[model samples]
Target: MTLRNIKSVQKTLGLLLTVFSSTMLTPIVIALIYQESTSLVFLASFLITGLFGLVLWLPAKKADTEIRLHEGFIIVASFWVVLALFGALPFFLLPELGLSVTNAVFESTSGLTTTGATILTGLDELPRSLLFYRQ
Candidate 1:
């Protein structure tokens, strides 16, 4: 693949990441409504993810938009991996949740992929924000 194609992928991934970062707002809102302490965590996650996305996009903004077939696949894969990591941020940030990195990643991946598998127990006892995020 040419450098141009790589840049295209980078630009696309950046934009996608920024969009994905905004999804953090849903959980933030849930936290607000439920008066859960996790609001700060979710808001922090949103900012961090969004800024990282903006950093990626800003440098690649001048790159051409056209993407090759391979670049498309690469972008898709990258989206899943990056998004899963960011999606795990809230769980990782929550000290009381007691989630290890592996469990957090698995939980986020499962939620993102809709696998319906979770390591969490006592779902009913968890805060609304966490429940909403997992949903």
Candidate 2:
């Protein structure tokens, strides 16, 4: 891919990331409603994800080039990868979970992809925000 294509992908990914970051708020609200301490965790996750997205977007916000077919594939793949990584933030941030990076990413990817798989054993004891996020 050319530099322009790369910039285009970056630009698209940035905007998508920014939008995706807002999703963290749902869990925050859930935490508050359930009176769970996980709200802070979600807040931190939101800031990190949003800031990363903004950093990615600000530089290439002006890219006006069209995305080719191959570029579309790249964008799709990158989108899922980015989502998985960012989606893992809250899971990884919760200290009580004691989840490794691999397990957290796996859970995030599985949740996002609706794979219905889990490494966690105790569902009833988990915070409601986390349970809501998993769904």
Candidate 3:
């Protein structure tokens, strides 16, 4: 509840965000090897997510504190939400999928949460990199 603890959570989330952004790179590599044309989408997603992470991290990183349990829960939830949004970027950007932002969010959330539910159809026709990320 203290300002320091909150700062710790922010710092942790920021670091986590940066780390999470790196996950996008794998799909980028996949796109490169497979020539899926979605490489740029993954790259853009990586840069945007990385920048967002730094924006959240750099300001609060100087706090130099440990995260408390309550703050840990908050951080976990915040990270999941932010991660889902970031995860949906490629789906939203890809023209072939024809996914709205809302549908993209639903897909990303479902994948990340392992809910096995999605609004997407024709997965067999989707790009491999996208499918790999969802899987």
Q: lDDT of all predictions, in order shown?
A: 0.90, 0.93, 0.88
Candidate 3, 3-90: lDDT as tens digits? 7888898898888889989988999999999998999988998899899899989999898667667887898888888889988988
Model 2, position 93, has a per-residue lDDT of 91
For residues 19-86, what per-residue lDDT tens digits would candidate 2 score against the true structure? 99999899999999989999999999999999999999999999965989998999999999999999
Candidate 2 positional error at 19, Å: 0.6
So what's the TM-score on candidate 1? 0.96
The candidate maximizing lDDT is: 2
Give the runs in model 2 whose Cα sits over 4 Å from its true position. none
Model 1 stretches with alpha carbons more than 4 Å out: none
Error of 2 at 55 (Å): 0.6
By summed lDDT, which 10 consecutive residues of candidate 1 come out lowest? 1-10
Q: List the residue pairs that clash in candidate 3.
A: none
Over the stretch 15-109, how does candidate 1's per-residue lDDT look in tens digits? 99999898889988889988899999999989999999998898899999987788889999999999999889998888878999888999999
